[model samples]
Target chain A: MRALVARGLPVDFTWCEGEARARALSEATGAVGRRLDLTDRAALQGFLRAVVDEGAPDVVLHCAAVSQARGLQDLTDDDWDRAVEVNGRSAFALCRALGPAMGARGGGDIVLVGALDRGQTLPLPVHFAATQGMLSAMTMALGKALGPVGVRVNMVALGPLGEGLSRALPASLVEDYRAFSALRRLGTAEEVARVLAWLALENTFMTGRVVTANGGI
Target chain B: MTGRLEGTRCLVTGGSRGLGRELCLAFAREGARVAFTFRRREADAEDTTLRLRALGCEPQCFQGDVADGAHAQAVVGALTRAWGGLDVLVNNAGVQHVVPLALLEEPDWDLMLNTCLKGPYLFSRAALRGMIRARKGTILNVGVFSSERIVEAPAHYAAAKAGLRGLTDALAREVGRHGVRVNMLSPGLLDVGLGRMLMPHRVEEYRAQAALGRTGTAEEVARMAVFLVSDENTFMTGARVTPDGGL
Candidate 1:
């Protein structure tokens, strides 16, 4: 979000709005932040309408995710429900609310930032993987639906962040990841932000695709 | 004058003619100290060098087959020695033989795969050494539009191009931590290079099919190529950007 501001792009923040971090970021960036629970479809729709009332943006980025991880054995129905509501359902809700307007405008870009689990050989948290997979499918389907109308739908699949996970992981594990990659490193948030900006702004012909942003994982 | 890639040390493979030639010219115009590979066309390479010089950029020309690992090593070695370190690499050397799979011989298949797939792989391997140390570099691989489909006669060509997607994704993930980016640029039918000769009978049909109702220009593709490797592209890696005028 800060990276986008640095690039001189106008950005609006929309989330459940309780975290001090989100509030501070919004204040620091002078971005309009909305407090809307994505689980409620009507609230999500209303929030988007309010966004349009402020200003119809050239790009609407869906970067929200419930960063909860639980193995399949310990997962319950509620866990699945929470994951679906936060990660999977909200993406579709945004598309349904915003897709038509963007289409009517003759062109717009919708970039969904998804999780790193892309059927990799390694084991993953079942619910997180499921929602991520769902989001990936929806991105492709929406991309095809909106492509002819000039609205581009794309997804950016990211791996562990350099600032977040890299700081927490042990040095040995970090080195393991590096050895796994050809470039041998993790990705920075600025790098991912740059990709989102490019897809939204500079990309001319690319549509209906997943731009993977994992360091060669 | 000052450009986005000013003072950048760059190398482009198979830059004697066609789309590759345009890429070389465009890079030179952007203030990059450019070195390009030519397999056999000495005259074309000389002409390209002269054109770069006209643009006020000192351009180096190397003759080698990128598919041969030794030649790829030599190309990278010479560039590193001349320019100190390589910042950008465009894997554009490619060859195609438009023949049916039934008639495609072992050597022909080898030629297509080796040039299109193995060449990029070998060059990327060599380039990564310096790039890893620098912790900042960009690699662009040139591919055809039919990367995911079988629209042309040469199945081997399509296969080779498709293989690049894997290479791009895998390499991007591995080197991204190092601040290096790798991407594939798949261009659609153009009025230049081998595209002019590819499916000559069906060129008009392909043009008509595009949303723009025309074939793309090499300059158009070159512009996108520059943007992909430029400083402006901060977040794009493991991506295959196709500028086929919406085919």
Candidate 2:
């Protein structure tokens, strides 16, 4: 994407990854990276307002989340709210809020992250599936509605990404995870980031769509 | 960014129109040798090929009806033979009969099922032979929103897309050990040639109910498809992407 910007496309970005990372991204791409905790409604809206004020962003990419692999009973309402708020709700809010500007401008793109959890259930992490299922619905409805405005919506579904929350799993689960992936291995951040970049930057015609970037499955 | 499919050979179905045409152009831009199938429009195929060739990419078009068996075999076989080695098969040829599920016609049901479901199966069955031989290949099936949502489609279309999703997962596992990756590229409301017809309203009606308040384009979906087929996505399978703007 930086390369595309360098090639002279008017590029802008607002990252919620955190202050330092967001700042680095802003510097690398010359994009306005606003570091707002996506879960904080007030902060998110305010920050996005400021971003819209500064200059309307034509594309909005929701890439923030909190993950935990607790058992079913171990899951709590707080976790649900947090997951919903952070992982999925933030996207809903951003689109709900900032979509008008892009539409008014006559065009833009919004891409979210999804998972296979909606269809296939895993061992203990059901919340991930639940929110993702809602997220999928939102993607579909939004696509139909927003397509007329030239504001495209889409999602890149994900599989397990790392050894962080996953390494602590049972050996059997780990084996299952490995075998479940078409590549039979773990994915890397560069790999995931590349996907994010593609959904945001290239292939301009696809919207209200879901493309699984989960290796080969 | 490195153009992972730089020299890989690819074949995309429904290349005579919309998302298929966009995929052909994008792949050619990325330095891939492409062989895309067109059902009957030799003119559209030529236009696509002309555009691809203008990009300094090798492109060829074949004629075949995805709904038929012999044509599918000949087309898939021809592509595999032309390149001497095929690396990616994008099974994307599909048709939709969008109506209130309650009012969908029986013939429309068959059209939906045969085009979306049967096409992928036939193409995959044929492509898998060469892929397993090479021990490396990618199957990117273009699916629909019906797989995840019960949008107003004939039961057949929805069921077929749902089945396609399942096929992607199961096939991903079945061929994982063979070094083959199976994936589905499911687009929601899109701005491609078909989307313009699917929901002809001005779209505000749809937006009022949508979470994202908009539709997407074929290029964006194509980009996602390309990334999935790229080398970077090395550990994901049985995944579904809802590129619908936050619906």
Best by lDDT: 1
Model 1 misplacement above 4 A:
A52-55, A117-119, A162-185, B1-4, B25-30, B40-56, B68-74, B105-107, B125-138, B149-153, B163-183, B187-195, B198-247
> Against the true chain A, what TM-score does chain A of candidate 2 give?
0.82
What lDDT tens digits, residue by residue, belong to model 1 across residues B65-179?
Answer: 8899999999899889888899999999988567778988999999888999999999999999999899889999998888855565368888998998888877887778778
In angstroms, how far off is A182's CA in candidate 2?
Answer: 3.4
Q: TM-score of each candidate?
A: 0.82, 0.72
Give lDDT tens digits, candidate 2, residues B1-41: 54667987888999877899998887877778888998778
CA shift at A199, candidate 1, in angstroms?
1.9
Please give the range of 10 consecutive residues that has the lowest summed lDDT in model 2 chain A: A160-169
The interface RMSD values of the models, given in order, are 3.7, 4.8
lDDT of each: 0.78, 0.73
- Report the lDDT tens digits of candidate 1 across residue range A27-120: 8998867777888878877887876666566788888777444557888888789889988888887877777777677678888988563635
